[model samples]
Target: MLTAPVRTMILMVRHAEVHNPKDIVYGRLPGFGLSPRGEIQAERVARFLSARNADVIYTSPLLRARQTASVIAGQSNTATVRRSKSLIEVLTGYQGSPNSILVGGFSFYTPVKREGDESMDDVLRRMTNFLSLVIKRHAGEEVIAVSHADPIAILRLGLEGKPLTVENLHSVVYPERVSINQIVLGPDHVPQLTYFDVVRSMETAA
Candidate 1:
């Protein structure tokens, strides 16, 4: 006999724009908050999720992601947002200088140097571990997770069984300003991405 599959909905969202005008490549850097437009975007995202019934709201420890989650939770009338360091953005290989390159729309490519930061493999590990924990915690409920760009892409790749190499990082598209990716977690402990890069409408009247 085959075991029944667990039914859970995971909404993975990338945080709104940041306040970095110099484009200093603030990978996992502190003191980076959302821009003014990002605040509006976050509010719009909150309205988007207000229509859905979310059991729990989770956010990355990063300030921008946490702020985004807070706004959404407030709109949805959620009591509190859970913060997880595991959901943080990938640590970059470069610090002060802007070494990260944007490619093919929302895809980003960062060349690895000896004096930089974490590798692509490290990012994959962090993303997989965080997703595994989330799947185990919410077996049969809908959960929302707000995080950064690279990690979200990494998680999607992991769920799709794609290789986590530098070349293949661009396979998944990171949604702009509160885009949602829906994933279903089954009993086999694997997540299947149902939809990705869903643009939410800003108007509340709809």
Candidate 2:
């Protein structure tokens, strides 16, 4: 029997810019929140998704992701932000450093097998697993998941069946672009991305 197409809009929102005046790597470092401009960007995202009628907002426990989710939910006057462990930042081998050359290494096949780090495939697994639960929870509804750049990129690449390299992380959405990725889930519990977008702005991100 031919099955009908099921639509579940999952707006993948990258957290707003951070308050890093010193320009530290700040990769998963605790206590970093949105910058002044980032707050503006969060407002823009909240406004952008205002029409989404979001059922529930999911966010990483990280301050930035949680802040973004709260702004969207507060502005939309709906959906209280929920801390989802699956939506948390990807664990990396590297902790904190200025040099980006040999920082946290990302993998697509095997787990990085380092201290507190995850492979790209691991990220893909958790991200997809989280999405599956969201689809099941809000079948036929729009939901928002706010997370970091690399994790979001991993999920997008995996959904398209594309391999991930260090460079592939560039395919992620910019901060506050309010990218809406419409995901369709099959009965077999697989999420197929039918639409993906990032609202690029000509002006500098505010």
> In lDDT terms, which candidate is top?
1
lDDT of candidate 2 over 52-91, digit per residue (tens): 7888888999998888888888877667677888877777
Q: Which ten residues in a row have the lowest lDDT in candidate 1?
A: 100-109
Per-residue lDDT, model 1, residue 104, is 45
Clash pairs (backbone) in predicted model 1: 6-187, 93-116, 93-117
Looking at model 2, residue 186 earns an lDDT score of: 48
Q: Each model's C-alpha lDDT? A: 0.73, 0.70
Model 1, span 40-127: residue lDDT tens: 8888778778888888888999899988998899988643689888788866545456635543443233555444466666777776
Deviation in Å, model 1, residue 90 alpha carbon: 1.0
Q: List the residue pairs that clash in candidate 2.
A: 107-120
Candidate 1: list runs displaced more than 4 Å.
1-5, 99-111, 188-190, 196-206
- Candidate 1 has a TM-score of 0.83
Judged by whole-model lDDT over C-alpha atoms, candidate 1 comes out at 0.73
